[model samples]
Target: MIEAIIHGVILAFGLILPLGVQNVFVFNQGAIQPTFLRAVPVVITAAVCDTLLILLAVLGVSLFILTFAWLKTVLFGIGFFFLVYMGWVIWRSEPLKVNEAEATSFSPKKQILFAASVSLFNPHAILDTIGVIGTNSLGYSGEEKWVFTLATIIVSWIWFMGLALAGRSLGKLDSGGGLMKRINRFSALVIWGVAVYMLTKI
Candidate 1:
């Protein structure tokens, strides 16, 4: 169980450490919004989607695709192009809008759906969770496997929620705009790095 949890954290960080759209969105949201209340709905949405992927990985369906050599090749290419496209978008994104009204009356459903669109549908996120994490899960058994899977899910919940909470601290930041732009730029670099790594390694 401990081994699984450790692996899970490693996998979780592998994905979480990247400067992807999710991180950029969360940072931007935190910087310009009423983060305490807004972050919950957003993080909850992302965490639920992440949980579903972890569950799928645990069930072993994701591992099945890894067995097919050609499919794996195709998936790597697909993931690579997808990351490049997303990186371009993030690179071009305008600084987050600071609408006080939007922050105060944030719509939970809209945020959830928006987050789902980014996290669940993004091919890079899917490949990381399903392809990378799923492929790695095969080296465990019984309690260890379950612990590892649970740890992966918990990582998603903990990291995103933690990011959301940390964004609340930006409320005290005088230069929120400058700070957020830096976060977005940092996230772009991380995303591009991961994408390159994924493309080359697989």
Candidate 2:
């Protein structure tokens, strides 16, 4: 069980370390939002989506879903289009041009919607969750299996909260908004790159 917990923690961290669209959006919201609490909707939504993915993967449901070639194609297609659209939005988000607070302040509904989109719509994220975490969960059984799953879920929640906190801290420091604007552009490019990569995979 102890080994299971350690394995889960390391695996979760490894899988999430990449600069994926989901991570970038979460961080972006944290940095742009007027306050830390304002970023909570994205954080919570992301965490919940991850939790859902982890559960589906561990329960073997995701593995079953992955067996369908058509499903993968659909995922890749939708994800590619979504990333392209989202990238454009991020690139154009000029907090300084419009009323700074009003421009950056996404409603809770929008936050949740975007958060879910990045989490669920990204085929790479889904594959990682299903292929990596799901495969790993097979190594244990009964209590150990569940312990591993719980550890991974906990790590995900903690990592997202930490990211938001880091973003909030940086937002406080970037009063001029210059650095954040650069980040938005850079983030958009990264997201577009991911979209292209997905198309190649398809």
Q: Could you say which candidate leads in TM-score?
A: 2
Compared to the true structure, candidate 2 yields what TM-score? Answer: 0.94
* List of clashing residue pairs for candidate 2: none
What is the number of backbone collisions in each predicted candidate, taken in the order shown?
0, 0
- lDDT of prediction 2: 0.87
lDDT of 2 by residue, 25-108 (tens): 889888888878889999999999999999999999877778988888888888888889888988988644212555454678
Task: Mark the 10 consecutive residues where model 1 has the least summed lDDT.
Answer: 97-106
lDDT of each: 0.69, 0.87
lDDT of 1 at 202: 64
lDDT of 1 by residue, 83-153 (tens): 66656655665444444435332356755655665676555666778877777788887788888888888
